[model samples]
Target: MAAVRVEVSVLPDSVLLQILALLPPWDRLRAAGVCRRWRRLALDRAVWKHVDLSQRRLSSGSLWQLLRRVLPAGLSTLRARGCLLSASRQRLLSPALLSALGKRCPQLRCLALSETDLRRIPYASVPASLTALELRRCELPISWFHPMAPSGTLRRLLLHHVPAFADWHLMAASCQHPLRVLSLRGTHRVTEAGLLQAAPQLKGLRHLELWGCGAGDATMGAIGSHMKQLRVLEVVDCPVSSAGLGPLKSLQGLERLCLELGEKVAPKAVIALAQALPRLRELQIVGACSGMDEIRLSLSHCSCSHSPQAPD
Candidate 1:
């Protein structure tokens, strides 16, 4: 008997699409040239819903070509990290490209741009349908967050190492956008006063993370007073001491609390936090002092019925 022969073309379109979906973005693009059927399956909306160009060194022309030829209108998430960097002082993400993106990809929901300069790009050029935006180590305009409208769909925002994110931008974001989750790291210019003023306006915020943002007792107090809806809070490398932890006790809705403390915060403060918040489910305390062993022992011996998880 002759040996049986098998071909990928024998597979159903659904199965072929499932196989193609596992390939990398560039690999999928390459696979599209194999055959007409394969091309149609490779360019299916389901296969290109999320495109990550972080690893690729893309120029403006190549990006434009990809947007026009490869990226589907059903694309929801796009992460372009360090893809458009140039040695010369030329903007890779021109207004025309941004406008085309907005018009072409109406379903774009989440966009993340890292290690890219957006100082020249108008804030209004950002896609209006985005529910999440992440900008890391990017040079932003002075009024980046000011153009966001209150009626926009943006819910989550992460700004890492964005030094230009000042109090005015924070205030504008708090007032204009209905953000539910906000993370700020290495934004030292945002003072405690900024938190005091903006915390109240972020009534819908549930998860907040602040790292090296100069938060203190007053900032915590303001959060406890205004941000009653906050469920998860992470404060790392801030100026908050044991005294500052007192205000956090009033956060009845808080479930997960992470604090990276220095010598100023004592072991007992961690115990107090574990016992104070009624809804506290997980408590992570990273002490930079020599009493970390003692802190662990104290936390282990604490009689709080909540039984907070051990620090990670």
Candidate 2:
């Protein structure tokens, strides 16, 4: 009898990571501990290109251990895809881990910590490479923005339901970079003065979203006049009207405008917007504002759609 020899080809690190990315969290963690080579490969940033830690059922100690073990040596990008951290569970994320991440991931650029507590963020320390940041439903203090971030690299910023902006002056001063995109939805404390102070710094801005804020016509006009590069302006759930929209007519570069019509904008408001801002490509009117009388607009490159009813 003769013994037969067999051999199997080994997959490359990149290919192995691609395979590991498809596995569940626990399974991936288990695979990382298989061997030294496997552990190193699994911890590579490529394996976490699109991390989704939603409903992972991870304990505080276990989460810290996993982050310490699995996170790559020098990660350049991180996406906390829509993870919810309850008050009690927030303790699981240690300040040490956050600080370590800030110091280690100096090349990190994009961060999406949606629906997580901002108290978890060591605001005093942050990666200099951060450019795009999304903080949704995060409870951060006003002092969080006092620490000057790496300004030259920052571009996009989104803050939703953040009450910490009562002293919005600090935010304006800290955000000195020319932002391309800015969104502050449901930031009740956001005032017109704060926006006015910040608009000049964001001269290169193209998209601005200010929903459910107190900013009226004056604020919009200020931004429209300065941001010559502004393209898309969305001011839904605000008190601004078509008269306030009048200033945007000169914004030859403007493309999209989403406004919520109310007391400030009468039935004749749409007529003025259509007459002016000929470059506007898209217009959306929701809530009570959409009930305005339909005005026939003849524009070749523009489209208009309005909801007769408010969002349910």
Candidate 3:
């Protein structure tokens, strides 16, 4: 049989870019090195709109190269989890590098960093245009939330497993930023009093999640009283019971409610909550008492998920 040849270069740029987009970030970088034309197509703003470096051990030099050469200003979302931002005394994400990133990627909105040590990085160094910021297991400085610029665009903030996150940090963040959605998980230092104090400041919040916190019924009451605009509420392993959950009925706009309660929570309270929140489209109750069966039976018509284990 005669040898056949397929010229991939003949493919349309749009098609080629789509193919490149399907490749992993590292693979895409390698493909870009194939030829100048491939590199050009690979660097398309559309292809790099959302870059996920969660699996890569990105160093400072590589990060600088990415900002200066690879990433376009049109980049919107960047997820760099467990990135080695420093080695020895040198920091990977230096102030100058972060400044360069802000100047280079003006449109960047969502920045997610997990398990990355950001103790040295100031909050002011973050891109001012960002709308969403997520940090998990990051060693943040004591004054991380302090001296932050008044950001009208920054809305969603998620912090998980940040042991250093205290009541003062919450108070500072709520007072400074006009957050629409806030999620705090494994921040044990945040007490019920702190939440109550911060609740009034977060009146504009639409989505709120509290997990592994010291939130009690009082905190829930404060949220119900102040954050009437809330649409989604997730309380997992908090010290809240049915009494605290009672005030949640005031949230007429609530569409989704997730409760991963401890053994202390009653099943009847869950039922009462389901009944009160008629607007609730999705209700998930985990670790509720034996009454969960009865609650489920009562609210059979409603869309809900009742399980002993909470979904990860």
- Name the candidate that leads on lDDT: 3
Give every collision pair in model 3: 85-92
- The parts of candidate 2 lying over 4 Å away from their true place are 1-27, 30-44, 56-60, 81-94, 119-122, 147-152, 167-170, 263-279, 289-297, 308-312
Better of 2 and 3 by lDDT: 3
State the lDDT at 114 in candidate 2.
54
Ranking by lDDT: 3, 1, 2
lDDT per residue, candidate 1, 1-312, as tens digits?
999887988989899888888778889988989989888988999998988887765566777888988788899998886533565334457667888998999999999887777877877888888999998877878877774554667799899998788888888888878899999998988988998889888888899999889788888888878888889998877756777888888788888887766566766777777677777766666545555555556554232221122132
Ranking by TM-score: 3, 1, 2
Q: Any runs in candidate 1 off by more than 4 Å, and if so which?
A: 1-11, 83-90, 147-150, 289-312
Question: What are the TM-scores, per candidate, against the unseen true structure?
Answer: 0.86, 0.77, 0.91
Question: What local lDDT does model 3 show for residue 48?
Answer: 92
The alpha-carbon RMSD values of the candidates against the true structure, listed in the order shown, are: 4.6, 6.0, 3.1
- What's the lDDT for all of these models? 0.79, 0.66, 0.82
- lDDT per residue as tens, model 2, 122-162: 56555557788777676674556553654455688887776
